[model samples]
Target: MNGDDLTKEELLSRFLQLEQRVEELEQELTQKNKRIEEQNEQIEELEARLRKYENPHTPPSKRRSATPRSPTSDSDEDDDNVRTDGGTPGRNDGHDPEWRTVSDPDEEVEVTCDCCPECGEDLDESVGVSPRLVEEIPDPQPPVVTRYNRHCYECESCGTATVASHPDCPDEGQFGVNVIAQAALSRYEQRLPYRKIADRFEQLCGLELSGASAWHATERAARAGRCEYEQIRRHIQDADVVHVDETGVKRDGDQAWIWTFRTAEHTLYAVRESRGHDVPAEVLGEDFAGTVVCDGWTAYPAFTSNLQRCWAHLLREAEDVADDHKKGERIHRSLRQMYVGLQAWLETDPTVRERAQMHRSARAELTSLVERSETDGAVATLLGKIEGGLDHWLTFVGEPAVSPTNNAAENALREPVVLRKIIGTLRNDHGMFVHETLLSLLATWRQQGRNPYEELKRVARDNEMISRAQAVPVVEPSG
Candidate 1:
């Protein structure tokens, strides 16, 4: 009786285990199928994009058309000859063809020899010359040994005379500032990991360095340039208008955030624990006053300055409002009509005075729509916000000093956002600040009408700061 009971219990357990395994397999299969479907959808989308550029006569990946259309040019009579009906007639060189050659077929060839071979008559016997690919030679920057003088003197006339002591130099075995800068640039801009940078130094430069050594050097360089980083942040805050954006980043084993604040003429970045108002507050400083243009992120409004909302983001929001039927269709129709009317008004300005007049009228129309919607529904709420901000959109219509959009500032930080997506974030808050601050300086320098590479080169060559790796060294005693 005991054996029979135990056997029944074991059979029941095995059956339940089999059922669970089957369920797990089914779930995995479903996920796999879903992934396959998504991939197929992406392939179809890419194919559709490719079709836009596809001409039956062109090969894949290569552009098909030989000539590009000049929009404002008068139509040609023979597809090659310029119009001669009314305006000044263009020259019919006959050399000008309908289709342009990508590579020159009529390029002259050099004659190997001018002397005749078959008959005793001089003839032109030129052979086609093949294009020669030239290899670029990089400029040589051989390291020079630069010595610093430490003069020692003693005045022994009095008994209290003593020798002038010299401050200790950097450790003998560590890399110089130039080497450290190269390593930092390689790791930061080139996105190489510390160990990989160490490997590169050993293999390429005949220097044996450890990952820890590279990290120390980078940390030292970043710390030394903190003042310059602060200066860059100040520059961003002082700009006329600022655009703000954020992207997800990783820190150690957790998720983090990277904030980018860029103006048309400046850029500043700050890595924060949370994507909150404090990030902009810290980077922008306490007394910062400028027109901050950003998406409708709640924290963005906390800044104590006139905020100019991005029209592009507002347009997308308006789209959502239209999709939601909580408000009547009249709201959607109203928004569409207002935008269309505004676009038309924008094009009618022939002079500065006319442009100002047109802008004022358009703003008034937008304001009237807002005032009418004060007692209405969901669309009304959205329209009220847009209408209230109508003045911001019109601010640049006639003013040459302002930009019509926040695209320039957005463009400044787009690459950094992409980088954060690719490489993730710094390990800790300190590491995050160092990375963001240095990169901010690099980005702002480039935006401030200066060359980034040139600045980096100057820093690498002229800066005499010591890396953390060279803090201590073994001393050899002489007899």
Candidate 2:
């Protein structure tokens, strides 16, 4: 077995065997690396899919149902708070019965039982009477049809023709101002489709109306309210603090955006083809001096530097992250605590100096939070958003007029979003115009505590006056 005793052929054979073993090990390593690569790709795909269900932007209505958990040993303790049987079965004792009582009755009827229910005893005189008021709507009456004969006359001196105008008749349209106002209100306020609105008119008023006619009526209302809509736009530009938000919509089979600019006093909506900074620029103007309370959409900062990033949106994003990562949970808790503390501090009506100090302190705390290294992708992404809008997060703390969240704009958008769901897409540019115009007037009027229907009727009357005045042909003096 010694080296001197071994033959050259035996040594060569041993060398070949060692080489074969090394080649086999290299081949096995390559196979293991390929398997790892394949597994990594699968993991990436799974995370991407999970994001659809876990991301901050995904609404709860769209999110997937969570996996149900099995009962633990403490299930009974948890069950203590759960209402297994639908809340307390009946009304609580000591609560007085409530009902509306009309002071003056439009009409009254006496109810005297002819006989007793239990026995066949005749009862003629009533001992006591209890009055119960029932309020009901009267049956709808048919709309009135008025015919006007516009008298045409020629001026004696200039030989110019003139027409006499009446307040009862509009210059052009067949439908009256009231019908047009109702159509616009029904379409926007009630969020009814044109066809349904026409059907409602026919059913309720015994008026014959087509969907096309309903649409034209809304268009006319929109035209009349354009001035008021412009006024609201001007008001938005002049506001000290405006909450802004946008939602995606469809117009004529193309993507569009509906932007809402809202203050405490007024609300304005704009339906635009672009969801860019230009839309805000056009609405608020490039030199807008007011602070905008909005979400972290890139377009907002592009429009103006004064901003209060929505804390609700940031907290929701953190909550999304916390569902998966432990670090994210800590971040979410910290953000919630900060928000709650800020709200409580605001409630104390802090002075300007105190507000400044609080802003500085909050900014420092946010910087510290952002500085912490996050290895988890979800946590890192959330931190990235915070870091990007670090300056905006504390704007509301310094500014008393601004709100910390963009809830106003968000709430204003709910009605339009519901309308969007009902009518998938606006048919054309005219439809988009009508949508933004009528919605703006309706929202503004409601915010201002005006009856929208009555206000619209006033607008219609003004429009008729303008139209009739413009219709009169004036001839210049013959030179």
Candidate 3:
């Protein structure tokens, strides 16, 4: 065993054996490192998935289901007394019954007792009269069909042909303005499918309408409203504050986006193939000076420097992280308290100096909160978000006109989202155009408190006039 006593060959063989053992150990170490790396990746993936369930950004409809509870014991006596039929039958005790009376009557009918039921004797004595009114819809009537004969004449003075136009007729379509307007309302406001709209017209109005006709009617309405849509877009650009948001949609099985730019008076929707900064820039223009209220999506910051990041979205994310982490809980509490305090300060109708002071104080407090060190992953992520949006977190405190949330844009998109769910996808680009134009006009009319049906009819009539003007050639007479 001693080196001095061992032979050269024995020493050499021992050295080789030691080297071989070292190589085997190195290979084993490499395999173990690979396995550890694989496990780490799996752990990260699971955490990400769990976060989706825990995060407030994930809608309740999409979140994982909670654990099922044990079945309730039907043997319990208390269960028998629970009323499942919707509460008590009558209204609450303090409420009074309300009966409507009409001031004007369209028709009147008088009734008198002609015979006594007991003895079959005719009696016509008017002592007292009680008036009762019942309102009912008249039975559906067939739609009136009118045919317009547009006569073409050649002007002898200029050798040009001109066509006579009628106010009741549209230049291009067979249906009148009222019919087209109703079809558009049914499709956009009521969110009815084309086939359903056609069926409804056929059953209710005795009009044999095809799905294609319904679609064509909507297209005409959209074309008519295109000017109004552009006007809304211009108004959004000029607004003092605008709320912006986007949601995913599909067109022809390809990914698309629906962008909403909303103000207090107007709502504009754009359907585009892109969910990038270009969409906003195109709508608001690159020189837009108004403040935009939006969420923390990267596209927004890239589009505009003037922004009020949505506190609702931030608080939701913070609330999610706070559920499991202590540091995050503290951060969430601080943020919420600051938001509430800011709101309270705004309610007092502060002067400009006061607003500036409050903004500075709130910004400092936010900075202090984000400065706190957090070892938890969720907490650190939240702090990073706060730090990233540090400048925007207090923008609303300085500007009284701007809102703290993008709820307007979100609310405007809700109806369209429901339509998307029902239809699954817009069939083509024409469908997208129809939706964006008609939906924008209808929403804007509603926001402005205008009668949608009347407004739509006006737009349809205006479009008819334009078409008629375009169709009739103007001839110049030679002097």
On lDDT, the candidate that comes out on top is 2
lDDT-wise, the better of 1 and 3 is 3
TM-score of each: 0.58, 0.80, 0.81
Residue 145 lDDT, candidate 3, scale 0-100: 88
lDDT of each: 0.64, 0.88, 0.87
RMSD per model, one decimal? 14.8, 7.9, 9.5
Residues 1-479 of candidate 2 have per-residue lDDT tens digits of 88788799999998899999999999999999999999999999998998877678655544665423346534455444433233422355798876756567788888778999999799878889997877787898898998898899987897878888888688777999889999999998788888999999999899998999999999999998998899899999999999999999999989999999999989999999999999999999988999999999999998889999998889989998898788898899999999999999899999999999999999999999999998888899899999999989999889888889888898899889999998999989898999999989998898989999999989888888887777767767687
lDDT of 1 by residue, 1-479 (tens): 45466687788897899999999999999999999999999999987876555422222223433344358765663554433232224444575656543553444544376667887677575566666433444554445445556455544543333333222233332566666667767766787888998888777666777998888777755665666777777777787777787766778858777787876666777766688887788878767777677655667767644666565555545655666555545555665676666556666545789778877876777676666544456666677677656646565556544555555555655666667766665678667866886687677776677765556545543333333224334345545
Candidate 3 wrongly placed segments (more than 4 Å): 1-54, 58-103, 117-130, 472-477
TM-score ranking from best candidate downward = 3, 2, 1
Q: Over the full model, what C-alpha lDDT does candidate 2 score relative to the true structure?
A: 0.88
Clashing pairs in 3: none
Candidate 2 residue-wise lDDT at 378: 85
